[model samples]
Target: MTMTRKDIGLATRRAVLGDAHVARAQEATTAFDAPFQDLIAEGAWGRVWTSEAISRRERSMLTIALLAALGHDEELAMHCRATVRTGASAEDVREALMHVAIYAGVPAANRALKIAKAVFAEMAADTDQTDSEKGGDHDKG
Candidate 1:
């Protein structure tokens, strides 16, 4: 069966953004923002992210760079966290932000880097906690 745009978008958004994040966003949505959320799910996540022209990793890099260039710090941080699911490495993020430094200016890149660092740290910590809870000693032999 052919998937609807909302179906495609919801799946794409969850894959890229993670179920926890998407669930939180859905929970936080109000009547005023519900339509806006649907629009992004259909347009950005469905149309853009599901495009075959680029890999999800490439899209993650581009999204991060664009968010940084536009000084969208919150979205930049969210995308940085989403990179864990998108397979966009920290090195890729560094390179993308380097481009941002030259084209979007040093200030924007600097702020983005700071945000990326914090987000990475948070992700690492979460991973460590999960591993520990699973009885895995990730830090030991």
Candidate 2:
């Protein structure tokens, strides 16, 4: 049976990425992009992401590599953002970039790395903001 938009979005977001990453996506959604957001959550995250054949980790690696190969910086950044949910380590991402360099060319990999670095920095800043809102207790303990 087809799932409701809310359910599909929630499930797909959580399954492929994770609750934290999905929450960020939800927070960033705007009225203009709401429909596009829903479509992707259901189609990309829900349908494709929910598939059982490939593990999330493997999917993440494949996604990063493919996006880089195609020089699809935007999608690469998106998948890089989702890597946290897919259990992909920093090392794993680095390995994927290295492979992209070998197969896709250094220029493609370089651009992807730039996007990935920016995305990662943004994620870190978000985490810091959240921590500060919670009283910056993470640093104390």
- Estimate the TM-score of every prediction: 0.90, 0.68
Candidate 2, poorest ten consecutive residues by summed lDDT: 9-18
**Model 1 bad stretches (over 4 Å):** 136-141
Best-fitting candidate, scored by lDDT: 1
Q: Residue by residue across 31-110, what tens digits does model 2's lDDT show?
A: 99999888887777777777889988988999899989998887788789887778897678889999999998999889
TM-score of 2: 0.68
> In every candidate, how many clashes are there?
0, 1
Top-TM-score candidate index:
1
Residue 54 CA displacement from its true place in model 2, Å: 2.1
